[model samples]
Target: MIEKEGFAALVLRLRAEGVTDLDLLTAFEQTPRTQFVPPQFASDAYSSRTIPIDCGSFMEGADLAAKILSKLQVRPGHRVLEIGTGSGFTAAVIGRIAERVLSLERYRTLVTAAQIRMDALGLRNIIIRQMDGSSGLHGEGTFDRILVTAAFSAMPRFYADQLVSGGSMVAPLILEDERCMMVRLTKTGSRFEREDLFPVPYLPLASHIAQHL
Candidate 1:
């Protein structure tokens, strides 16, 4: 288990690494990562290393997560759409920063567990659902920001279309050379402006909904 002092130290370390957003930092600091991981991996909660979650998914490391949040620049009034809920730790953190968060997970087991964790933390603004996130909630209205936790071989047009003009999406994109890197796409009048953020190794975003966990 990471002691209180250890967690604080971790936050401080993130701060040193350029995660300077106050609200983003606070959201991460308050949302206990230990609660999102399995009991066997509790000790690795605050480390800068990926950990496994249910349905063969992996939760982003705390440091990388903080960086993603920083790049997101979520405002208090922004509505965020998270493509993969995974353990729901990122959604939980975003729930504290954004006005609302609609997190999509393909597996029912993950949806149930993530919802339970959200409810336990009193995060009423976050809604976790079991759906193929690759499609980007069709009937649902637009979003101010979209965070895709999985890497995409190419930028999905549907996701860019779902964002309101001037809104942005931060996702792991597969480069031409087959290297995966984080990229931010800002929608502007039916067009998107892309910016590269950082390199990352992530599983491809699945398009098919799982029938079984």
Candidate 2:
């Protein structure tokens, strides 16, 4: 468990990492990262590194999640979709801000763990689905916001099509060099504009191009 001073330091570090949104920061502060990690790894939960969970999945650190949420411009009453629900911490945070959150995890174990965590936290607005996150949730169109936690070589056209006119998405993108950048995309008319937010390392999306090849 992070002490008050330690949690404050963590928040300060996140702010330095460019998470300046007050509401997002508060959500991060309120959610206990330790509760999302496996019992053995709980001690390292507050660290700014991905903590391994069941089935080789990991819980993204607060900094990465904060950046993604901030860039997505999440707001109350918005419908959000999160690809790769590892620990449900991010989904819980999104649930606090958005009207509804649909989070998918490819690994059944991870999905179960996330669901348990959400239930324990009393997060009622999040729906956890065990499915292929890369292909995305079929039939759930036109989301107010979308956040992909895993790194993808190419943006899914289906995700873009699902975005509401002014909706936004934030994901770790794998570039030509195999490097990853936290990229934010926002829909405008028939196209979406991309912005390079920062660098990040995330578990590769289960449906990555490498898998297809």
Candidate 3:
């Protein structure tokens, strides 16, 4: 398993790549990635790679996570919403930097597992919920920031509507032929602006609706 010093080195590497926020850096340092990683991959926890969780979902790749967090610019007064809680690792990271984190997952099993992991780590500010994240949690009030761990093919309007004015959002956008890009969005008044960034590969964000007869 990787030690604390090794994790620090990873943080430094991220800083070199422009993830210079002290709050985010400290969060990465304090929260052990292994806590949220699957037991089989615990040894490589500190490495900058994607780790798979159960149910066909994968944790956000380290590079992508760093970029999203740094770009979100989560402040102490911010309430952040996470669209995918793969392993709960990113949620914990955001919780340490922001005031509170509310994560939505499409899979109920993953939500339960993530909740258990978060509870074990004593991360109280982050809440994981089982819901269709693509639909957005618009009924739950606005958020100061939003981070999406998976890729969306189209702009999620509900997320934009739920964002507070001046708030920022970072997400991975999927395109055709195994292509994807990191997108940063800012909400101003009733409008939203999108800024497409460097390409990155991330698992697709699933969309679904429930029905009962």
TM per candidate comes to 0.96, 0.90, 0.90
lDDT of 2 at 142: 78
- Which regions of candidate 1 are displaced past 4 Å? 1-3
Q: What pairs collide in candidate 1?
A: none
**Per-residue CA lDDT of candidate 1, range 30-130, in tens?**
89889999989888888888998888999888888888889999999999999999999999999998999999999999999999999899999999888
Among all windows of ten consecutive residues in candidate 2, which has the lowest summed lDDT? 204-213
lDDT per residue (tens digit) for residues 103-184 in model 2: 9877777777788888888988999987777876769767998889888888655677888898888888999998899988
Tens digits of per-residue lDDT, candidate 3, 97-211, equal: 7888999887777788889878887888888887778867867888999888778887776676788889888988876766898888899877779898778767777776222
- Indicate the TM-score of model 3: 0.90
TM-score of 2: 0.90
Best by lDDT: 1
TM-score for predicted model 1 compared with the true structure: 0.96
Tell me the alpha-carbon RMSD of every candidate.
1.2, 3.3, 2.7
Clashes of each: 0, 0, 0
